[model samples]
Target: MSRRRPRASFAIGTVKVRAGHAREVGLPITRLVTGADVSLPVHVVHGRDDGPTVWINAAIHGDEVIGVEVIRRVLTKVSPKTIRGTLLAVPIVNVLGFMNGDRYLPDRRDLNRSFPGSARGSLAGRIANLLMTEVVAKCEVGIDMHTGSDRRSNLPQIRCDVDDPHTLDLARAFGAPVIFHAKLRDGSLRYAARERGARVLLFEGGEAWRFDEWAIEAGVRGVLRVLAHLGMIEPVEDEPPPLSLICRRSGWVRARRTGILQMEANLGQVVTDDERLGGLSDSFGRRLRLVRANRAGVVIGRTEAPLVNRGDALIHIAEIEQENETPGQAELAEPSE
Candidate 1:
């Protein structure tokens, strides 16, 4: 005789998902000018066994599509009948911005910067509040997926509070190329979730508005590893990723002059202090200046835009440290928001 107790239905808004089943719940947002209703689509996978609930969200900045793919692939591997915990997969967060291929909302507010918001606030704030109340508040862990924005590309890396023992362990299981010890920003989703007692891992990879196969693979593998670590699923079949490097501090190297750029330093390459990273030239083929690193570190991000203005960030470097050594002071500049 089966000894399983009667499973309760998981409710989100008005939608209830029976235990060991999955449901797509559309939480009403608002109505369009054309009288069409806009809703936040949430994929709730309520597992058979009891365990921790986790959320994986992507496309907070609509142009960052890599995370959307990562969530989709992850959902395919996890089944409601076999898993131990609930997985709230929100594949798209900025639906309005996503529809228009933009990064911000219609009112030009960054959705990421509006968090733990009020119900009667602006559109971005309301949306953030909705997500916080409907999904993140119920979870113990969250993974907010992202990529380099404003025409920049990033190496696959995990950003979290490396000082926290538990979060650090989760980051290690994520198996990104690097684990950046990042501090929380004022209005970020990670910050809001942290305030609500939820641990978060921010995954950065690829460039905006395009799909990167390597980044997608890393994200899929990392999410699976995290799930396994949490005992929500069985062990992953693939070989584990290589050991991740730890970053104590990171900063961006800015352009010296306004011109067309040709980057010489590739992503993931180690460079010495003040080493040449790229060159700049005028439209008339006259050499302008050579861009150099600000410190000894690994190249984690680079600009994809050819034409840049003076003081524009051309490359991002993370000062790496061994796991045994103590983490250094805060970053010269935060690499990501």
Candidate 2:
């Protein structure tokens, strides 16, 4: 018979978190202009029993704040004594951008695209390297939280490689409304982590800089359910998770005219091809054009901005396959990672 490996304290940086306990540790990032140090704060929960280690992170985009709250609430519910494995919670990864309410770092680089970075690289790259070396490298699974950029909003959804059987099972356990089979982008954290042999789930919902209550609630529930599925914690007593809508293809509908957009399509609402989604009009109230769906799918994301330029994405629709439907060839929508 195979023997179980001996358990030990979880060592992160210089802090050794003892088993059956939790601690908040800080990993130094840089020194501000005023000489004050900025560090990435992490909450480490080392469970009593042995199991797979998982890391949950938020604010990768800085402005996507909903996951911050989700992590906080999840921490409140999980005790090191009860959990079966280690849980690493990072509430804010882009501390510089988060402090300034900016999506990109002070160097104007998207942190999400600077993964597996060199220690001597740019600010974004260095931060990415710190996370990869100190946090991601220690985990078997990672949950990356995000939201729609700028004025866009997303329905609660899980973006991942659903073709992988283990990953697909975890996505379903997450209980999001939609499970999107998204391809990994180059230099993205998901791509980098996968390269290191870790399963990753990217959660997208709400919008930047605001707390959408529904999205926050769903996010909390989904994280807990994933923990349960991993056998790290006991199952939560929420409603049975949805028979998630599996989506393989998605496309964006753009505005044909530069004008004020009045949208009728709601997030998570299903629309048929050629259905009138809303209309566009000029400043004088003259109708310029009408926005319509090009395919039948669920409305997964949409622009909340009233003013839009020509060719700006107005609505995002995902072609879905139900649990009982036969899988078919389809393409996913192109959007920022």
Cα lDDT tens digits, model 1, 1-337, are 9887957888899888999999998888878899999888899999988989999999999899999999999999999999898999999999999999999999999999999887999999989999999999999999999999999999888999999999999998988878999989988999999999999999998889888887888899899999999999997866754567799899999988999998887777777899988899999989999999999878788898989999999999998885312222222112332
Clashing pairs in 1: none
lDDT per residue for candidate 2 within 148-232, as digits (tens), equals: 9969999889999998999999998998888999999988999999999999999998889988887888899899999999999
Model 2 vs. true fold: TM: 0.93
Candidate 2 Cα errors over 4 Å, as ranges: 1-6, 323-337
**Each prediction's TM-score versus the true structure:** 0.93, 0.93
Q: What lDDT score belongs to each candidate, Candidate 1 first?
A: 0.88, 0.90
Worst 10 residues of 1 by lDDT: 324-333
Clash count in backbone of candidate 1: 0
**Candidate 2: worst 10 consecutive residues by lDDT?**
328-337
Candidate 1 at residue 187, lDDT?
83
- Clash pairs, candidate 2, are 249-331
RMSD of each: 4.4, 4.6
The top-ranked prediction according to lDDT is 2
Error of 1 at 202 (Å): 0.6
